[model samples]
Target: MSAVIALRAPLDEDLTAFVQSLRSLGVAHRVAEQGNEQVLWVPDEQVAAQVRELYARAPQGDPGLQPAHTSAQRARPGFLAQAKHSPLTLLVLALTLLVALLTWGGDNYDAGRWLSFVDFHIDGQYIYFGSFAQVIDSGQWWRLLTPMLLHFGLLHLAMNSLWYWELGRRIEARQGALMLLLLTLWFGLAANVAQYVYGGPALFGGLSGVLYGLLGHCWLFQWLAPNAAYRLPRGVLVSMLIWLLICMTGVFELLQFGAIANAAHVGGLIAGCLTGLLGGLLARRLQRR
Candidate 1:
């Protein structure tokens, strides 16, 4: 038999710590559900005594003890909460779908040319030098802004969307959606322009560069404030860099695969890290005053 303990107030952070303590004490238990309320299951025999001891020392508002079953469904991250707090992340997702539609429709529909208004491309033999001239001659400076929203294929779109959704939400929450959007634009455009000059033509496209920027922004923000409310573990930073390397892995297998804008990836990753660090510094400097 098992007994449930319902905490009156939510236990979000100290949960793992408390659970570890229970294990060390030779107590058998399991977390039944998570939400505004958390249900802790303990053996029926030990429930009464533990309840008494916990009640004496527990913080105010804690229910201390209740009967709950293991069969109860656990709580999941609420979709509503996510939308209410980070609506921009949701908006970005919608725009991503629109981009996919434009990609497919543009090739098939006569209206596709309109979509190309923002797409960036390299020209001629010089993969590095050509893109800049094209950017300048094309007079589509807005391509720097719109390029972050474009994708090459279904697979490319899906992967980029997944990353945007996952990372964008947390970042938007911490820095606000407007700021993240600005950073993405700055890094994406700057990286695209830089790579065009360095990578030398061969035509390029995609949002991987801006994604790299977001990755760097998140990493530096966390690094600068290790003890801050949204601290990220060191592993996350390493993982971001590793992920960037994997994104560039396409360069090595270029012969087997179709043309890839790896230069944009490298450039974007570099730009993102630097921009993120700069943004963090700017924020801190402002906060100090």
Candidate 2:
């Protein structure tokens, strides 16, 4: 439970240098404490204790070194683990469950009438609009946001909500809840608008587009915010790219998958990727200044 604290030298607060120095101390594990601080845990033996004392004798101003008893802290799940607990995920799952209940409860469900009724159509176009656009032009601009609340079927609701539940946890953990909420709305609305422009007035309703947007956001974040440690790893990016390619192969259409709007997928992805790049650059610039 003895954690090694960083003793930064005067004018030598480089995080990389500090970490390298810690590595030289033969510490096997490390964790960030805050900006410019870290805690390194080492076996508490006489030799290691001597090494710690010697390292603490740097000529720079006295930076305190304390043995933090982490037995209690390490015994329980950390913040990230607790934040991502299944109950939080269940909240999103429950929301989708409610939507599915309503969709299935309707009498007209099998007739395809109920499904078509909720779908968004661009006026005079073959492409589907995001439910947002239809709601907006129909003088229910408020519905632009609420239409995302609607789900057509159990599978549809389950897929979207699962994505929201899983990815939403990671996004919230990295960017905080407020940023995740804003990004959800931004990607959802922007992609829907993009679909209307590109798909030429087709009624579309689904969260798949927003899922694609989140995928793009994840990728772009890796590129733009590499050092932020919040982006997806390379393996995830490769797998997602493969998934997108497969989706675009038209197999779903050939199989008669009804109302899967790939247009919204493409549109939302493009918008979110661009926005993620912008956000990363902005964050980097702010860090520099």
Candidate 3:
């Protein structure tokens, strides 16, 4: 895996000379544009040190090398690059959006009935059996995961999707797609079960649980692996924690923000923290060995 060491948009001639120097030194490297900046990535930290040394020794206007393509002329990596870097995150985002679209506007859709993990009744008659019971009775195991795909409204979908993208991508980038997938499933199951246990047999669904899980995972992983890139800004952590506290206080319902899944959030955070703690400890032990 490569680590980005420098982020600078060098002049055409300078970039050409730099690339030539790297090639001559047999250092593997790549250039990628992130937002408005061009990033220079080297596969090894040792190679990055050599690159820094070369830059320091070379003259500013060395006329030995020909001009290369400008940074603007280089093609910018798009969605495919993003997906490649964070496939699990993008896949989850796509599935969530598709489910949101399919179940839009209508509250009585069969999709929701099949996805939610709770049983609900009307007038003393069972309208739909609980997902957990159905899985045991009918072998429809997908119900455990489908709950995380359901969203109630546009605002709900937008907020959850935004957080998922922001947090999920970080985990996927730093950890791996497999880790992200496992964490999502684990968090989804724990959160859905917690919500069901706490408020039983009702309509509730969103990725807020998974979001909290990602939040906790990143929060703790950064503490354990300071050199790892899985860091969250302090402001983001504080704001989210404050919001969680506010939601738990039943303020959202009072202000007409609708019902808050306080149990799911708490359960997800706990599960994520545990997972992160274990992962961090394991990572540290491995590094020591």
Candidate 4:
């Protein structure tokens, strides 16, 4: 690759967006640190002028550079677009919906008994049986992560699913599906364990905790790696935090919003923040190297 342009130190949002544009165009490029500045490199000299033009035009709000789609590109269907953009997110959405459908509006559907990590009470004392024991004893290890798939109502499912799609797609698009899956499992497990610890064997389940984790991850990741595409608007961050505070204050319960898993939310946020911080530091280090 050859250096196309030397962008100024501390790259701005426009430049980062331009980089993403170049990537979307399938341009092979790399960002290399050069003393006090960073240079954008393209592999082909023939495309140097094109890259330069795009970079110049990007800041001026002309990002609609749609490349011609070939017969091969047009051969695939529209749903493929979602798969390509965020397959993991779509899969989770489908699974969550399926679980909700199976457990919703059915007199025999005991979501709490089936999905909660611990659903047993012995002599008025709640005993916690986590995934480890469940796996060893009953081989039902999915108990650890299944709580995230259980939603109390349509509103709960809709809100969590929307946020998961929004946040999960960004992470999967930037970091890949594997990272999203790992983060989901980590946040889900941590949140479930936290809720179980805080509220005992009571029924509590939802993806809100994992959603909070994604929020924190995106917020911190963007702060540490400004060039990253995982950008979250200030309003979103504020609204989510406000909701968290409200839940902690038991206002949701007072308003008949059902039981809010406040501890799970806290746990998920903490896990996501730590993950984001580490991810950012690692990305910065790799960039420097």
Candidate 5:
């Protein structure tokens, strides 16, 4: 089972006290030692967030931290309630769905061009792509990040949205919506630019790159902190990396998987790992202090 680090106390005394309070509150947790600190791990992201909140408000193990009854612990929220906690994640999903509908899951070329990495127009029996100079002259810079909003088919949309929902909300809840947006844009831009260089002026759209980015971030972050919010299942990490390698082997195109964005996947993963390293170091520093 994947567990999250809910508390990282430098002193064993603090860990013991907090563990006692958490136990009284009936929160399922485990304690592990990481270098000079004692890290408390919990089952899920919501529980971790709640534990952090209560601990922040009353670090001395007050009644607030240890509620009146064990049942006072918040039950997991349904989809709507969870969406409220991560509005930006929900909003991005909504936008992607809207784009999918507008472009008929990427078959509508005219509509797709508006959001592709470069401007284009459909002519009789052929599509014309704009030159980089033309795109630059038009001052339509948003194109770089918008391709991620496009989806090529129902299955593609569903798969990407499901993964985004799974990975995006975790980070949003743990960090915040603003951080999530920044990271999304960072991943999206990197993915788009890499695909642009790889395939040049082609219509490629999907959340696959961003999905890899999130997976990469979570993989590295979990290694650094062992936080539940960032913990990815072991099989999941290996499976994705294996899939990426398979895609790079040109088997997908041969099998008519509609031209895999291999470069985008690699680029986003690299960006996410770097991002994860930076974020992990900062978080580790905060925990030590």
Candidate 6:
């Protein structure tokens, strides 16, 4: 069914992400070959007109397809579509995945050393982690935050990544990328600090603490402001809290499971909840205004 909707010369590689948008929308169309440039083809003229209208109204850059006005026309965006709107969240996910790759799912200590909470020296398969004070004295302030990027295993990385992808994008969507990045750094620092304080130079890392922070933030923010962005189900937040309590009880450690950074989780959760409370209040005031 030849249905060329419109053509714009020279579609570039950037359109790859935009293609995900069409897929998410169930558009049932494809971009023509390079010779046809940005031409779109669909099954029939009606959908072609819809595409034309969407393309015509957009200002620039992949037709700037905004969310549909009606619920029926909208589809919950796929991964790429979400990534397009939430670049900061996508970047965190990418970095976590990249670090996992570099560390060989947390087994390659030598490779993952630099990404840890503290700088370290290795001698005879034994790692000597540096002190936090030393890191501060050396002006290596990044160490304070880098620990959240380290995952001890694939499961560690995957679980943290899933939650972060779900929650980080919520913050990025609601508060903007800059705000999301800043909050992430803030939560990461809290998590790292608490882990260092409790575990004391042990090899520990993961985004779980930051995930808890995000969960807490969304929990309290929605509680206070009732915005759709932070509207998570009550059961989800309760389950996370229950899990945290279970971790704190040391059952996992006793069962030969890996060490759980309870302090980091608590610290990050406190920080996130505080931020949520303050941010929610501000949002409510603004809404009133």
In lDDT terms, which candidate is top?
A: 5
Rank list by lDDT? 5, 6, 4, 3, 1, 2
Per-model TM against the reference: 0.62, 0.61, 0.72, 0.75, 0.76, 0.73
By TM-score rank, best first, the candidates go 5, 4, 6, 3, 1, 2
Tens-digit lDDT string for candidate 5 (109-172)? 8788889888888878888888767778999898889999999889989999999998999999
C-alpha lDDT of all candidate models, in order: 0.59, 0.56, 0.75, 0.76, 0.83, 0.78
lDDT of 4 by residue, 182-253 (tens): 999999998998997788666678899999999889888778766535767789999999989988999878
lDDT of 5: 0.83
Stretches of model 2 off by over 4 angstroms after superposition:
1-93, 105-138, 200-203, 227-229
Name model 3 segments beyond 4 Å from true. 1-80, 105-108, 119-135
Q: Could you tell me the lDDT of residue 31 within candidate 3? A: 69
Tens-digit lDDT string for candidate 3 (218-262): 888667744334656689999998999989999879999789899
Error of 6 at 108 (Å): 1.3
lDDT of 1 at 36: 32
lDDT of 2 at 20: 43
lDDT of 1: 0.59
Count of backbone clashes, every candidate in sequence? 12, 7, 0, 0, 4, 0
With candidate 5 superimposed using the best TM-score fit, by how many Å does residue 34's alpha carbon deviate from the native? 14
User: How does candidate 3 score on lDDT?
Assistant: 0.75
Quality of model 2 by C-alpha lDDT: 0.56
Candidate 6 deviates by what RMSD? 11.4
